[model samples]
Target chain A: MNEPQFALRIRQHLNQGARVDARVAAQLRAAREQALARHRSEPEAGLALASNALGRLGGVRGLSLRVLLPLVILGVAFATAVAWQQTQRVAEVEELDAQLLSSDLPIDAYLDQGFAAWLKRRASQ
Target chain B: MAEAARLAIALAAALLLLAAPPAAAAPEKDRRWSELNAEQQEILVPLEGEWDRLEPAQRVKWIGVAKRYPKMTPVGQKRVQTRMKKWVKLTPEQRKQARENYRRISKVPPEKRGDLQRDWAEYQSLPPQERQRTAPKKKPVTAQ
Candidate 1:
């Protein structure tokens, strides 16, 4: 209906937490009226015409890349970090394998210095 | 004259022997386990057992730490000794309890753990009297 009545309805809805603000409701009602008038004036070329035009223009894709580029960069950065962490773990495993294969010392010898010293003494003798 | 020719051949053989990649000296095996101080030995014995079961790669990983043992600070050494003492003193039941506690603590989200640590710091900073006051009180039961 009129703006004042629409605003009152919106205020009531907002008070109940339905979130319809007076200004927004009024704008919505105006848009609906305009849409209805357009349909009445051009019955044959209705909402379908608007829908076809939106489809041809690829609707949401028309938004500028400025908004989407940051999201794309963030996703790439997250994936790279995950990949780098995986590679780091793999490298650590490889290094451990290399060290193990190259060393000749018995595991106990590394832990026990007295045993190592005694062995050295025996070898020299 | 034939003896001089044989001597030259012997010299050539000696040079060839010297050139043959100094027979890969057998890997220097360290036998340091017996040298540890009693306390150190006590700590190391279990570690040795665990090390024995480890794959070569795992053993190699720990060898680097072993090599740096002499460079460890006195405090570091003492801390290690204390941990070893504690490990030795624990009953199997107590060790199980400690392990369960560790697992429970580990499962907590990092943010929650950070918050808890911060709270602990705050609690520790409070005066002894204030801490006593904040401590939980036993509730009295009323008969219905």
Candidate 2:
């Protein structure tokens, strides 16, 4: 089928919003097969180049793993150390809070309204 | 004579009490702003009203920088002054826009930034009249 005729038939089917006819389906299938066959037969230099490149990369993969594995491990260890330090700091803060609550010093007593009033009176005098 | 000596000793003790500095004043906690030098003051005045609005960590960060680089070069001082002046002139919305632009520029790769700077230097080297004539009429379209 001509390109224009094939496009017209596809458009007509789309406009009708119904399923395509068997003949149109067969034509489309044939076109797709033709394209695939051409693609398979073509001598693609890009593919050959890519295969050669991958072969080269395979040699470096071992070296890369040796270098990268330790780096990855170090990064994980550093992250864990930071998390542990943060947890320790939180624990220390809680301990301090507990100490503040239990202490004998009358810290809050000094902040009493009566004491403030007395200080204000003294300042005025 | 003994009475006079006793009186002198009492006066000496009183003067000693008066002259002694208070222990409570040793830890003189005051605004860190007052300790800034003239050049630092110029750089920091832009952040004046916004000083207390800053987080404790941010305040500490700036303070550390100020302490680390106590004195700046003449060109650096001038640049800081210009930036501060520009900062003060900007509206809140304009400031926000400037900050977003800065963040976007910073996110670009260092090599790209260097390239852009080199291009800008070349552009600036052109004669003023030529530069004005060649300048784009409209702002460059930026992708969202």
Candidate 2: residue B51 Cα off by (Å):
10
Q: List residue ranges in candidate 2 displaced over 4 A.
A: A1-125, B1-39, B42-77, B121-144
Isolated chain A TM-score, each model = 0.35, 0.37
What TM-score does model 2 achieve against the real structure?
Answer: 0.25
State every prediction's TM-score relative to the real structure. Answer: 0.21, 0.25
In terms of docking quality, how is candidate 2 classified?
incorrect
- Candidate 1 is graded, for docking, as incorrect
Worst 10 contiguous positions by lDDT, candidate 2 chain B:
B21-30
Runs in model 1 deviating more than 4 A are A1-125, B1-78, B115-144
The lDDT of each candidate is 0.45, 0.47
